[model samples]
Target chain A: MSPADDPCIGDVSEGHILRAILARTPAAEHALLGPGDDAAVIAAPSGSVVVTTDTLVHGPDFRLAWSSAYDLGWKAAAVNLADVAAMGARPTALLVALAVPRDLRVSFVEGMADGLRDACAALAPGCAVVGGDLTVSSVLTIAVTAMGDLEGRRPVTRAGAEVGDVVAVAGELGQAAQGLAVLFGRFRDGDDPVPVDPAQLAAGERLALNAQLRPVPPIGLGPLAAIAGATAMMDVSDGLAIDAGRLAAASAVTIALESRALGADPARALAGGEDHALLATFPSDGPLPPGFRAIGVVQPPREDAPVTCDGIAADPAGWDPYRDWDATAG
Target chain B: MSPADDPCIGDVSEGHILRAILARTPAAEHALLGPGDDAAVIAAPSGSVVVTTDTLVHGPDFRLAWSSAYDLGWKAAAVNLADVAAMGARPTALLVALAVPRDLRVSFVEGMADGLRDACAALAPGCAVVGGDLTVSSVLTIAVTAMGDLEGRRPVTRAGAEVGDVVAVAGELGQAAQGLAVLFGRFRDGDDPVPVDPAQLAAGERLALNAQLRPVPPIGLGPLAAIAGATAMMDVSDGLAIDAGRLAAASAVTIALESRALGADPARALAGGEDHALLATFPSDGPLPPGFRAIGVVQPPREDAPVTCDGIAADPAGWDPYRDWDATAG
Candidate 1:
């Protein structure tokens, strides 16, 4: 393809770029009013709307060479959807605010819009992009806010976990971190990132890469856990070790994990971030929800640490944006 | 103040920075569940929610030398709130997504939080910041999503205006643009922007600067106009000429404005951007809403242009981020 085939977004009008993106956006099921308006009206059936916002910025969040526009869009939507689901609500709509470099091609934005539509279709059936804002910037940033309906159920909050509750999880825990390791270890040339070559990846490595790029977190299990009388819930965005510790602190209980239940790589499972798996607690006597697997038990608060593995304190190390983001590496 | 006294955000944990901001954020009247949860649960008394998102980027949308952290936060909230107001809804909550450079001071972020709180208090009394996200980015960006309740009234969209409807506006027009002119015209060193000097400004220039920095749009008038039976409504972020043309196009009618009604500086009002005043249409027979004043009338569609001034075609020229942002100016 010739360079002229892909005109930069800077070369077009806002309406032209908007039309291209809107062409790819599917109709939202819960929207009473959609785009081309001052605001979108979304049906909040239970008289309450669940909302959360998450952002993916270049350098700290992703490297352009590694993440395609689709990957970036998918991850941005998935992450925010995970937050809404963690509150035991069904996602109804997404409002994306994109600030991108002017030099980027319009097709890149269309690819992102496609990814947003596909993610919503796959993860939450009725949810779709309802409205958005676009701005030009040197940094490529995707900030997505996902809204949801609780359908009359009480919201599941992290502070509700009771002592003696069963700690459970639904979705892969360490895969995303493994994918990050794969990229950092093999795909980088010196301090700069290089595009991934599928031929160089093993079967499991490819799976890991997909998990990192287009994570399919078990979003449905969130409402299922709530319906099954789960005591508390949260998305494990910053690994089990750190996130469980946070949950424990919020609930004023200690989370005791069994090392053997952590699967093949316990260390990575304990410290990995961005998996966005639902970490929840159900009453100890009740059977665990169908999609959820018990990994730990909630105990009375211990003075030593908020979380433990096989009765030993586990370090709650997780990705801290300010501390961990390496600007030079991106 | 010494730089040592104002620590960089990178020097602290995310929790530390969050606590500082959270301390300033007041509770929302409609928030069923606030911050600390995975997502905020906002009350939607009418069984539906009005949602909109708007972003302010460092280079294209604002310049740090000209806009203080407080000004940036206030303007970000004001713009998104106006969109909700334009929908004839009462804003209930705001979710902010902020991406800042690691080198920014924590105090700067705290000041932004203060501005967000004050804007909500002054503009929309019951509205407040309910949830937010923080991320690291090379370019500073503030993306805000505002949610509102329709209060059982039908949404007043831009497509509803009919021929003979009176075109009216609530809030100031072109003031923000005049403020921008003041900043660009007076507060620049070569190509780079410099801090605004109040001492050098005349009284009216100060008001213009305030309008640009902290816009106090007539937010309450939106629902009032809706109650008074507005046929169509939209915020005038772009100049009246461009935005009215959009409204006219949406409604398939021609908006004929009286230039005499457009204040002293009609040309500036027609071409300036970012004022965010509410532009609406009402039945010609009805008395104008208390806070709104008539500016024009709707007529049959015109082949030449959607908007006209004194029966002459008006150019729909306004700021285009991609075309107008100068990289070296900021």
Candidate 2:
């Protein structure tokens, strides 16, 4: 087939599409191995590799109506980057695979490219787009593989939290969750697609929407926490309460959150996820690192409750893939 | 959601599936860059990197009837590896992104992992699966990103062929086409799927099918050919005749094949692609590399022909993504 017949083709200006996409990504840094190299070369230091895979299918995870091609691209990259960061490693590079219907506009593909570039710039600077394959598909889908460098630190797995360490956060929380609520009409649906007031869009809500589309993972913070003598760490992709329970179960400990200490609305902040923030634990007396704030502490497990807030038992308040959230809501 | 409700959950056995998937993948040598490590590290020999991306959607490129989860995995890795090899580089590592329907067998996912492992075993030794994201989708799709080391060698691009160079190939051709014909019922239509008779299948045919499912690219051959003074080189994922035309057009040269010398049924070999074989050109008197066989030579461009065979103009015969092939009557 001619290039025109290749499903990913369209008439949108490639350069403009790319720029719009890149505008939202973070910057790069050293120790990034080869960010722009054919395949990035990160310093493994630990002699072992940690890997995972993720894909975003159109119509399900994202829609073309509220999100732009650039936004989609950024989100695709952000999710993968967040996964790497969650492993307590510094992300180094990425490999992207895209499938699109032949009728797609060329601008969309360029926008996707821009999103990838922007994400790499922010989270894993110098992270290069290596090699991928393209073909026509029934719908739009993106698959991304991110590479990271452990840099000689032991991987801070979910299975390592102890009975008595201070729990803390290193980035914004609940913002992306709120953003999702706004974008999907959890707040108000069937209205103007774009927000009417530019100011409302800019204040945190827009940033949250941006978070859902293009998450800026606390890339360096994971490793930095590990270096700072933090005992366990993970990126907050899932809501804090649910993910914290996971850490508790893995480490066979009880986690107690002092809800009042959490910024803003404690319940929303605790239940909301997709912040691309880092949640970590350290000795009760250890010094908290820069960009980190104390949120809670790990406690000895109770016979009936594995997670609690102060003296009260807590239940998971997060999104479930199979359950209908709107129906379950009061 | 419980793992069952998660869209990514499949019937595939987790450990065995991942192991089978890892088994097929080749290992990376400079460092451990595969699944088990916290993060993989690949050697980036070149200061500059070349990157590209592609994705495979189920039902369109492959059918569940002819392929297993393992086969899908291998095919995904093979396609990306072919691209890197085409760029005249040695593949270093890979990142895989997969999406599966929740009801899908977990074994299928594992099988896909097996296929990735298998492809790596054959073509990209020691390369690791660094990192990826997992999600649920309505359809099964695979995205692969491959990284390669250029090793200080100049990339052999499509734009480098010139007049007077002999065209040569390393690896088989047409077998994949024949296999496709057999698998898809182009050769013989029936009520039931064509049962492949093991005894009746030629070694080349078997090889071709294997190549289609898991193409073992001559990964280092591209750069090696360049080092051996070859003028241009590329992996033949498309038919030779079609790809040769591309080379000729890119370099502004004419290509002429000695049809009589090409053996019987050379058109089948020339027109069929998916071999993942390296095709290169060298000076007429230059010694052919050990694994390569001379096929044709470059010539001055004719007014009405970009390519010809036996002094007679020939029609393009490569496979097209959207067009049906009309095999010539024997």
TM-score of chain B of each: 0.97, 0.82
Please, what's the RMSD in Å of model 2?
6.9
Kindly list the per-residue Cα lDDT of model 1 for residues A41-122, writing each as its tens digit.
Answer: 9999899999999998888888888999999889989999999999999999999999988899998999999889999999
Clash count, one per candidate: 0, 65
Q: Which ten residues in a row have the lowest lDDT in candidate 1 chain A?
A: A319-328
DockQ, every prediction = 0.85, 0.27
Per-prediction share of native contacts kept: 0.93, 0.37
Task: Give me the candidate number with maximum TM-score.
Answer: 1
Clashing pairs in 1: none
Model 2's CAPRI class is acceptable
Compared with the true structure, model 1 gives a TM-score of 0.98
TM-scores for every candidate against the unseen true structure:
0.98, 0.75
List, residue by residue over B175-246, the lDDT tens digit for candidate 1.
Answer: 899898888788989778899878999999999889988999888999999999999999999889999999
Interface RMSD of 1: 1.1
User: In candidate 2 chain A, where is summed lDDT lowest over 10 consecutive residues?
Assistant: A321-330
Q: Each candidate's lDDT (Cα)? A: 0.91, 0.65
